[model samples]
Target: MLFELIKLGVDAFSSWNSNRSEIKKIKLENKKELVQLDHELKVAKAQSQIRMAEQDQAQTYNLDMQTTIDMAKTYKDEFILIIFYIPMIMAFIGYQDEVLKAFKSLDLMPDWYILIIVLLAVSISGMRGLFKQALELIGSKFNLKGK
Candidate 1:
């Protein structure tokens, strides 16, 4: 009976030690993840600052960017540009799943409704300046107006 009890105790001790070792491994993995997350957060902050500086530089040089800049500085332009560029980027990057996930999370109004409201507030006639600028850009690109 004593020998059986000693064997059982040994088995329990071995199991407990294995569990402790596993816990230690998991804790080390969690600590590593925390360090990686801290580095990622720092990188994200640096990227945000760089993006803001780029927006400031663009505003200084680009007159067409003035409207979006004046309205909400970097944020408005960034939101619009994100909507425009992210899908384009994702298509090239092969991240269609992320785009679909974004689409699924949107609980907003339909596009046609937003279109009608925008047209009323910002008419096509109001875009003449933009149209002129685009024409000038194309003309300059083709050297249509004798440089």
Candidate 2:
């Protein structure tokens, strides 16, 4: 579009100044009309640029808002999973003695070794989420909200 406008200017200048006697220079009234049209074109171009900027700003803001919403939803899901994992880990700890005895009665290995294996299983299953929740909680307290 800008190219077309530049071409129009070039064509107007060349047509009026070409070495053709039949084509005369613009009269005073025609010159005034031409100047008014040029002013109107400039105003129109500025208005177009302003509208484009407004649209681009709105698009960027909308995308930022959407990304925020998606992140919030993901955090909420993680929070719910944390809620579930904490109690399960606590229950395993609370029954540790009884669980060890049961393992002792059934095992072909030492009871302490069986206890270590069970603890490892329980910790592996849920400790990752415990650490994640702890870090997030600390981050929230410190005002380290991520973008």
Candidate 3:
């Protein structure tokens, strides 16, 4: 009877040891898998941060380009205003010369001729409105809102 009890105890001890070893192996494997998952999570977070930084840089660059474009538009508008005034000034000078010539050619200038000269002067100045409207039409067609 004592020998039988001893054998039974040995069998129980071997079973327990085997189960413990299996549990330890399973725990080690689970820990390794958890470590790998943590590494992957860290890598994904770093990649997300890099993408966000790149997006921010691109937005800043776009803002700078927009500002440059706005400044250039301002300069272009000033240049156009200068160009628009030049023709008006020349027309005024030419009308003065015509008036002087008319006065030299006649003892008394007729009212009709004086009225025609004044109308011509006014027409020359007002032609800028036609040019502005044409430009507006072209701008709208091309979607050139400039901003």
Using lDDT as the measure, which candidate wins? 1
| Tens digit of per-residue lDDT, candidate 2, span 41-137 | 9999999999998896676566555655665645644664675576557657797666567546767787888777654543433343444457679
What TM value does model 2 have?
Answer: 0.34
Tell me which of candidates 1 and 3 scores higher on lDDT: 1
C-alpha lDDT values of all predictions:
0.71, 0.67, 0.70
lDDT of 1 by residue, 15-50 (tens): 999999999999999999999999999999999999
Q: Weakest 10 consecutive residues, lDDT, candidate 2?
A: 121-130
Where does model 3 exceed 4 Å of error?
75-147
Report the lDDT tens digits of candidate 3 across residue range 50-124.
999889667656655565566564564455466557655765877766555655775377879866765444333
Error of 1 at 105 (Å): 63
Q: Could you estimate the TM-score for every candidate? A: 0.42, 0.34, 0.49
lDDT of 3 at 39: 100
Model 2, residue 147: distance off in Å is 32
